[model samples]
Target: MNGGILHALLEFAFYYPLVMSLIWMSGGIIYFLRWERREPSRVRPRPLPDYPMVTLVVPCHNEGAQVRETIAHLASQQYPNFEIIAINDGSTDDTGAQLDQLMDQYPALRVIHMSSNQGKAMGLRAAALASRADFLVCGDGDALLDDYATHWMMMHMLESPRVAAVTGNPRIRNRSTLLGKLQVGEFSSIIGLIKRAQRVYGRIFTVSGVIACFRKSALHDVGYWNTDMVTEDIDVSWRLQMRHWEIRYEPNALCWILMPETVRGLWKQRLRWAQGGSEVLLRYTTRLFKWRQRRMWPVAFEYVMSLLWSYTMSVIILLWVLGCFMPLPPSLYVDTLLPQWHGVVLGAICLLQFLISLLVDRRYETRIGRNYYWMIWYPLVYWLLNTATSVVALPKAIMKRRGTRAIWVSPDRGLR
Candidate 1:
């Protein structure tokens, strides 16, 4: 084992992410407290006003059988004044024919059939153009939007004119695989917690595309969704906020969505996400300097630090693998992951973070939290996977030429 500089770097590699996670937890708690202090009506009230005409955009590529369930969910939303515009983006399957049949059964539902497959951004944009409503909700064809989700999401937009988009909390539907079960906690511990904290900080890196609500005016102001960005969710979130439209996180607006069930699928999904973040950074560097956009500096700084930590850890791991050829000190080799004091401390930190997030998100559990025991291995797996994904994805994103068409891919959700 080395002392001084090497020791410090090793410590930094372990604790940097831990410290940031703690900060996010604290921020989310603070936000929760503020919400409690506010009036109940202000937090979120029932029987939302006006019942304004709302349009839902269903973007499909090759949605297969699951879209039947998705359309059923849309047809079942409890909201009074809403119309469905389901976009069949040139699916090679019977999705277009299926949608046409569904449309006849549900007259409120209108079908938009694209002759050729473009991408989600184009599909959403086309739906937006056809829509007569000011507010629009977009979701993938596999997601199950709660009957009340539209009401809750609509409330946020009606409450404020500045609110441009409300990102809904997505709950995992498939719990069949170990990977799927692990992600149930992953959403609360990582994605959900970060979103709550980032909202309190006055900036969010991106919206959850799986379930999101948008204002047509805001989309028009930003020129609608950018087709070039691989992740339209990241691109649209940045574009709206840069134009001074607020993006709100609506936890009560629950959308049940499926996630990847294999290491390969999980890796691909995460790499795509990481690459999307890098693309947003590359495309929007100039906007970050504007005086009005200063509030986003903290958000930008956090992302930059995340990348630095990921790359530094990757280099350290490579060196450690090379050092494996030679004999190492017994003390240095002691339980790098557990059984030692530092390992125990780091593990405790991860556990505490998840517990805090779990507390805040308990209301939306939906029979999912019964698998909490699986998350015992969460702290061990989350960072290791993220570091490797970012290491590979960032460089790929950079090398990719700008203006590449953003196509869609169906994630491998382990469901029979």
Candidate 2:
């Protein structure tokens, strides 16, 4: 009985990721052929009949270093009829002064200085309340919005009233370190592919927190951003979808954002992300059992299975470590730890997944292929890092006090 259970664990550990990779690949290919490839040019956003007034909300906390460049990029956007709103959420640095200086340079740029440090969710809510436009485009203070990104995202919003929000594509800008370089590929191969696949399947897991556009009406409908949620983006994505509002993935809406170059930064970022996801799952699990939420069943199931897979891998690792000190059964010792044909096949599939994603994404990101070599080793790195974080985050999610406001903190913006 013990051997049988161990075999099943090993099988799940090997095949679950393999199965998910294939699903993402097929769905991504289908989406490209059906929607993406049909577009005349991914480089340019299609011209619209009417340009709606859009307020670009930028919430900042100790981001003086990157704010100027971020605003500079937004000023160059191809989309017209838009205003810039920069919320200086109690920055200890000169972020307020910087925004004020930029306001003098750009007439349309508005600055809001909060007396105390408010979380991003509250900052966004405050921005939403103060916004003059019905349409709101929000991004990180450190992100460089592509010239055509606003136009691309707005096109989707204008196309249908049902589209409550449109998520932009985030491209990593800093690649000075090995960790940074791997993340470049990770975004294209793992994150980008997953978004495409999820979009094709009728629901996205979350929008890119770096850049996304939301309708003011929809924001009000869903109660704006949740102040207590660690990840406001993920929390809003679930709320909007649950209300029957559509959230779209717009690859043409590109934003250049920085990522963590150090191990500590990366671990912290992923831990928060994992915990946020777990919190959403726990919060919505009961609501999803109803007949009305049948579409969300697959997403919920996938998340649960991923959690189980992480625990299973943990068990395997624990047993392997124990085996180092004490004698173990021959069958268990030989079969559990070593990579056999299953590992070889899984590795091959991972490589294939990277190839397919890079090929599809190359037109939008011309230099993505340069990082392909780094991607070859991404599975090993990704598995260990993400699995560990997922395990650690689940308990944190469960124990977290509900309605507690999650404060904003200065994150590692990578090496300058």
Candidate 3:
């Protein structure tokens, strides 16, 4: 009996990862098919008789070194009727002095100095209150926007009155290290593909906080930036969507931001994100399942299932690691193990899915002119890092009490 139980555990351990790999590969195939079917024509341009008033709100905390460059980038945006507002969230560094200098340099730039660190949610709320623009672009101090990014985003929102918010495509600004190369893959494969899926399915899970534009009216409707959750962006996106507001994904509107160059940094960043996602799920789980809001259930279901799935993967990996040293019973192995031919069939399907992902990423990266070599090791490096983070994050999220906040940790910005 003991040997039978051990064999059953070992079989579950070995095959579960393979099952997850198949599911991920299947998702990749679906994304590729969608990409192939998408229209190739450019988004039509619409003339605006009067450009809407735009406010670019940047939240800063201990970002003295990079805040000036971010301000300069915002100041240089080509939009004629936009104001740049930088909110200093009680920085203990020279961030205030740096902002003061920049404020003096550009009359259009405004700075709001907080006496002590109140977190990003408070800073964003304060900045929104200070601004008088119809549309607000919230950004981090380390993020740099493309010259035409605001123009493209605003045009999309203006043309489509129903679009309550726009999410920018965040690309790695510095890719000098292997970790950075892996992150490039992460953005293209995992993050980018998920965003495309969400769009196709008419349900976006979270808007990237690094750079996202929200209509002021929608902000008011949903109650701007709830401070209770660590991930205010995720919470707010769900809030807007629940209220029947449309969120659009603008892949061409680019924002350059630094990605973690080390495993430790990446782990911390994803931990915070995972925790925030859990908070959002808890806060909105009831609304997510209501009969009137049935359409939004799939989005919430995906997130919940993903969180549970990560925990399962961690357990399976742990079991597999232990199983390698132990002998398994013949009966259990015979029952659970796939036939050799079946294994070969599954392997071929996985290979085909991986190839499809590679081809799609390659085509997208080629148009953007990034190095193609980065795509080769992406499946190993990027996917493993994600799985590891999810394993760590999901547990912390569940065990930790609500109201545990994570302050903004700047990514490795040495190159920038």
Candidate 4:
């Protein structure tokens, strides 16, 4: 009986990732053909009679060194009618002093100093409160926006009044280390491709936190960012979209941001993301079941299935480790962890899918082509790391006590 059950679970554990890979790859190809092949509309001039006033909010917490560069990038935006608002959310460092100095340099710069660390969502809320503009472009303290990114993102709002939010394409800024190169490939091949696919499906997991634009009216409609959610970006995206407001993906609005170079940093970053997703699943179960809230069914169902897959993988890993002491029937060979024919074929499919995506996104990114060799080894790295994170994060998400603030640790910015 144990053997039969083990075999069933083993088959699922091995085949499930392959199945998901095929689905994502196929969806990505179709999206590329239908959408990416066409020329982007950002280049065409709208020539607005009056450029709408925009408030660019940079929410900070202990970002003393990095925040200055970020503000400089914001100040240099090509758009004519926008202002930069720097909110120092009680940084222990010289961040408040730095912002004060910057305000003197940039005539349009405004500073908001919070008395204490209130977290990102709170800082953004404070900025929104002070803002009189209808359009708000919020970027993280660590990211640098392209000069025309603001203009491109704002165009979506101008073209469509229904658009509540716009997510920018975040490129990795640090590529001085091996881990950085791996992430460059990961973002271009996995993150960017998946987002395009989800958009083609009329659903996106989140409007990226690193950089996104939100309409003031839409923010009010959805109640703005949630302070308690581990990932406020993911939470806000769902909230606004659930209210039938549009969330757009503007690939042209590129923002260069830093990524983790160390294994510990990468693990913590992904764990937070996984935990946030799990928390959203837990919090929205009742609301998702409402008769009128049917549009979110697919995203909700996908999360549930992913959770089940995570749990199953965890159990199998534990049992396998235990079997190292007390021998059991092998799922594949029982004696060896060698790559079987099925594994090889699935791996080849993964490679093929990656190559296709690379070709599709070749125009957008420059250096990723040389990093393709590292991508071949990413599956082994990803499977072990992602599975471990899921196991740890799922429980954390479930047991999280209410009213606990979602403060964050500093992310590793690679070997800069």
TM-scores of the models, in the given order?
0.93, 0.98, 0.83, 0.94
Best candidate according to TM-score: 2
The clash numbers for all candidates, in the given order, read 0, 0, 0, 1
What is candidate 4's CA lDDT for residue 270? Answer: 90
Q: Judged by lDDT against the true structure, how good is candidate 2?
A: 0.89
| lDDT for predicted candidate 4 compared with the true structure | 0.82
Output the better candidate (1/4) by lDDT. 1
Candidate 1 worst ten-residue window by lDDT: 36-45
Model-by-model lDDT, in order? 0.84, 0.89, 0.73, 0.82
Q: Is candidate 1 or candidate 3 better by TM-score?
A: 1
Q: Pick the candidate with the highest lDDT.
A: 2
Tens-digit lDDT track for model 1 on 1-416?
A: 35454566677777887788888898888877876224242233468768999998899988877888998998888898899999999898999999989888888899998888789999999999999999999999999998888888888898999999999889888888778888989998789989888899898889999899999999999999999888999999998998889999878788989888888888889988998998898888888998898988888888888888888777667656655776655433322323366667777887788788777777677455576778888866767898988888888888998888888777786664
For model 3, residues 1-416, the per-residue Cα lDDT tens digits are 85665555555534654655555555555645764336232333344666888999999988887888898889888778999899888888899899998888999999998887777888888988889898998888989987777876786688777889999778787788877766666676567666766776677889999989999889899888887677889988999999989887766567888877777777677777877887777777777667877768878876766665566545545555555666544432333233366456544554454455456655434543254455556545654566677667666666767666545555556344
Q: Please write out the lDDT profile of model 4 over residues 1-416, one tens digit for every residue.
A: 77687678768767877877777787788877775567553354345555799999999888887988999999998888988888888788999999999888999899999898788998899899899799999999999998888887887898788999988888898888777887777887778777777777777889889889999999999888899989999899888878988887777788999889899888989999999998888888889889777878877887777777788877776775777778665652244345788679777977886787678666667556887888877877776788888878889998999778987566766678
Residue 7 CA displacement from its true place in model 4, Å: 3.0
lDDT of 4 at 103: 87
lDDT of 4 at 368: 62
Off by over 4 Å in 3: 1-49, 325-370, 403-406, 414-416
Q: Is candidate 1 or candidate 2 better by lDDT?
A: 2
Q: Report the alpha-carbon TM-score of model 1 versus the true structure.
A: 0.93
